[model samples]
Target: MFVRTENFRTFTKLYPIITTITAIHLVLWLIVQFSENFLHLTVGYNLLVFQGEYWRLFTPIFLHESITHLLFNSLSLVLFGPGLERLLGKVKFISMYLLGGIAANVATLLLAPVYYSHLGASGAIFALFGIYFYMVFFRPDMLNTANSQIVLVILAISLVMTFFTGNVNIYAHLFGFLAGTIMAPIFLGKGTYTRSLSQIFPNMRRSPSTAGKGQSIFWIVLIVLVALGALSRFM
Candidate 1:
């Protein structure tokens, strides 16, 4: 289910919400890269948020601290988001994504120091994992065994890295994941399931033999990339 068989054009058409969000990530990162002032104005500075700059909670979800930060989150969204987006529909999917990010920021505000600041979609990305986790355990029909294993293993790795990785917002990741898990039952209720991408685009679908190998490779590559990305913060 995590495998992406769609071409660039097909992917955008299939998952417009993910495409738009990733575009926002890129655009805002570019803006912040050139303008430190904009970053300060928009980043999730807890004190500023407490003083009534409420938009910081939502805006920082799209902001990134570095090129690696941007790519890691964006790649994660691209790889893992489509399945949930398909399952939840556009409106509900976007709502959950925003709420997860906001919840993480709220956790940051309440739990972290007042001077703390953070920017990135890791919290929101964890939210996606939380939903998948719910599926693996509670809604088994939603994901096959391979997809289920993928979610569980990746989530475990991410949670471990959350603590060990430097400059990470541990609260955001944990709380965002909790929020998604709590909200999953509501969003993933009966009748929410939709046609898989393979069903919709028969011509593009891979044979089982090819798909199995592709998914294995995809999973390994994603894990390696995520691990390397987390480790790269030190280098």
Candidate 2:
């Protein structure tokens, strides 16, 4: 799961996309178990109507109760991460992973039972699907034109899979898709991949740019909103 400079360079030099994705899949698998155990040690998650443990929202993404389920998520994560990471780089890619997953948790809490424990990378992968589609079809000029139609076709097929498949976490996927879609227009262009976090945070003035001190405010607000949203399920 860990990557050293040599391994990164060697793999990135060969199968840059696939190799990076494989690494992410491995790491995520480990994190899922760790998250579940951590939650049990602290808050705990339920099988259904998931306890408003709040942490369950994030932890569930890490644990897959079954091997087949893990396999599907790993495959999808590996397939999705490389393409998106190669484009978004490590920061935005990581942001997409965490934010998309959080977005999924939000949707799951709102729509499903609070005790219904859920886990998988479907939300993040779906976000990648949305972002990839945007980079390809919505902004084809950003990349080579030959890949544009191909990417669009792939997006269509994946969207169809959600509708046809029975247990594909379609709700999480849709939520991730919407989040990624909303962010795409803000960052999409024919230049280096970049995102502006300051736009969302209202207090960054022209001077005193050490916004690091206030980063916690972001999480505070996010968690508060999530907490309030989760409460709606019980009422």
Candidate 3:
């Protein structure tokens, strides 16, 4: 719903870091579906990590155990990631995502059971959601009261799910949320103005002038090609 209404047109216009991240997740999901060894190699907090493989700390964020898990995370990311990326720009947005998710994984390694195998983008998605929650109050202009209430409702539901659901990892969610809260002030800066996707691509349309129209078309094709190229890796 968020993707259909708020981001449909804009997704084509702007550099969608959120969508890119989601695509990466989906692509990896596809790989995991096709390969048996993929999951064993990439999952976080695994026995391999304890044995000296360190990259598992970050690789787990790219994995999901089931379609339901990926679906919920993808939805949350589609809702929250674009907004934050639009507000913070690509660099800071990505930084927050990596740092927040990694923080969650690190915390999980310390707090969760050694035998527990954690995977999926729930922590990262929650990290973005936590930043969204923080922005609701501190950057009210960007996230209005109505949107704020929606975020709260989603978070409340997630918290309830964490407590009630057997497979949910609350520790990852908690630490990710904390990481987001801690990083928001640093990456979000003091700006309150939220830039629309259209604003980022004001000259997206074909113009009457031949050169201008050509340039616009070139840009559109370039963006589409890049997106397709990135997507082709998983297929």
Tens-digit per-residue lDDT, 66-147, candidate 2: 4455555555564345656656667777777667777877887787654555566668667776776666545644545433
Where does model 3 exceed 4 Å of error?
Answer: 1-12, 190-235
Best by TM-score, which number? 1
Candidate ranking under lDDT, highest first, comes to 1, 3, 2
C-alpha lDDT of residue 172 in model 3: 87
* Residue 25 of model 1, lDDT score: 98
TM-score of each: 0.89, 0.60, 0.75
Clash count, candidate 2: 9
Model 3 TM-score?
0.75
Candidate 2 runs further than 4 Å off: 1-9, 12-52, 189-235
Q: List the global CA lDDT of all models.
A: 0.86, 0.57, 0.71
lDDT of 1 at 7: 99
Clashing residue pairs in candidate 3 (N, C-alpha, C atoms within 3 angstroms) = none
RMSD over all Cα atoms, model 3: 11.4
Estimate the TM-score for candidate 2: 0.60
